[model samples]
Target: MKTARRYLASEIYRTTIAVILVLLGLFIFFDMIDALDNLNEKFTFVSLLYVQALQIPNRLYDLLPICVLIGTVIALAGLAQRNELVILRVSGISSKRLLWMLWLITIPFMIFAAFVSEVVTPYTEKKTSEFTISALGKNSTKMDSGYWFREPVDDAHYRVINIRRLNSSTEIDTITIFEYNTQDNQLSSVTNAAKGILQHGELRLDNVTTRTLTSNLAQVLTNEQAPLESISSLKTQKTISFKTSLTSERLVATELQPDKMSTPDLLNYVQYLEENNLQANRHIVALWRKGSYPFTLLVMITLAAPIGFVQSRKGGVGAKIFLGILIGIIFFMANQLALNVGMLNNLPPWLTALLPNIIALILAFGALYLMERRSKPRNFIHAK
Candidate 1:
């Protein structure tokens, strides 16, 4: 049993590495082709290549589970084709034992996935985004409307901040802030700044203009009364300091997509959003999905295990690989669909994330059970 386990582990690891390399190369090639359209005097082909290289971790993180599935299927199907699987079974390794061995072998992969997702992917993704943005000379392309944040001032007041572009970690441009009165649910003020510097928990706005709506003006606006001089009073300042709870770290965190954030950062951001009474459903879903990734990979391996039991007479290795790919695609689509539908309908974050994995596990276990049932009759006949 030890020897069998070692052999299976070796085969799966070797095949998985090969698959990773092949898929990574293919993806890089596609990236190169796509990068062509973005080429310019400043953003040359080499710079684009460097950006693509930086994105490799994210690509690998996304592809790991599917690669594992395909590799497992190929390894097992090849063994079955050569009758090695039959020999192992005849040597008294039951199907259940083999399944357990596969799961055991998958532990290292789960660890690797966690490492990549938590450590490697986030750093590399941020670097890639920063590099691409710098190379392209684009300011606010990370988000179309800009990076928005909501900070509560008090029970009856809050501020909505919109930064058109982040020049750097400490610098911002085209800043717009909307201050609202929660008691009346009315906009109380709008602050616009040409640029800003963030330091020491204070944002210093240069060339600032603030429009404050008086109570009468607010009432007039709410009543749809049109009067030119009834407009809110506008105050301009050369420089103004605004204190905020958003530090540079929190600012950067808000700028990144939830998937590009580490789990801890994501959790913190989710809490921040909830505390500010902002919409965090999407981030919540992403948080749950990232947490459930290991289980998803386990399900992928389980799904692959049954494919290896097929004889060469029934289907070739190519067919089995194709089936593996199909399964992977289906799983990806189902997971995405669940995410979208769940977020749209406001489903629980954990349920939204784990629904597809649960369904896949059921299907995988059903396949395993059927395979075990078929093997039992054959084993009984052989014993008789």
Candidate 2:
């Protein structure tokens, strides 16, 4: 029994790693090619490699489900083909015991995945975005108040927008902007808005006050290239709309793509949106979806056991493997489709996140029960 359990664990581990590595290598090759095609002024070969390296965790997080499904099915099918499972069964290892071993094999991976998604993936994603944004030619200025980044309009003008907290697509909170004269290297003026929003591809500021700093603007123009204007001393809001290349859709995508955020960050952002009276259904769904990853992996273990061994009554190994692949595709699509539906229809987030896993488990247990019932009875009278 001990040897059998060890064999089972080793086989599953080896197969899972092999599948993951193959998938990652293929993905990395394509991604690197795409990056090389999009190469710009800021990204060197080394920097591009670093960016792609940071992307691996996210890719792994996305691919883990199918890997688990395929790996477990193939591992078990290998054992069955070699007749090792038949030997174990003759040695009085019941179907329940085999299922238990499968679950046990998946436990360590479940723990590892929980830590990766909650910590490693989020951290790496932040780094990836920071590098990408820096490559896009933006600079940040720190102030006593929250800092803003400079988005260049052209050679002689740029927009300095400070965002304290992003509320939602509808409203951005505590945003302040200082439009600067780049050629003169002087402060044009200062505008502070409690909330700024997008309306028809234009920015509208709310609770605004404007301060005209043109009086001392000459004193601040000390350098042509070093154009860091101090706007914290100005306590005023201004209605200044210098049409930036950043649209509402782009702004939201940069800051609020929940896939790139940690679970807690997504939750806080969702609450911030709700407080400011904005729609956060999609963010809510993303939060729970990230939180469900480990649980989904565990559910996949239960799912693999029945399906992997179901071929004892069916055709060949290829047939069973093909069936497993089909089931995995269906499960993945169903789960993704549920999340999309929830986001679009404003359905409950947690329910949508969990529906596919729940369905998979129920089907697994049902199949396991049927497999047990149809198997040869354990009791047999010895005739001497």
Which predicted model would earn the best lDDT?
1
The list of candidate 1 runs beyond 4 A from truth reads 139-144, 222-231
Q: Pick the candidate with the highest TM-score.
A: 1
Put down candidate 1 lDDT per residue, 1-384, tens digits, no spaces. 888999999999999999999999999999889879989998998898888888899889889989999999999999998899989988888888999999999999999998998999889877776665556645664568888888988888999999988766677889999998888778989999999999998999999999998655556757765675646788999999968877766766755667667998888888888988888999988888888887778999999999987666655999999999999999889988998899889999999999999998999889989988887798799899
Q: What TM-score fits each model?
A: 0.93, 0.69
lDDT of 1 at 321: 94
| Clashing residue pairs, backbone N/CA/C < 3 A, model 1 | none
* Candidate 1 overall lDDT versus native: 0.86
Shift in Å, residue 118, candidate 1: 0.6
How many backbone clashes does every candidate have? 0, 5
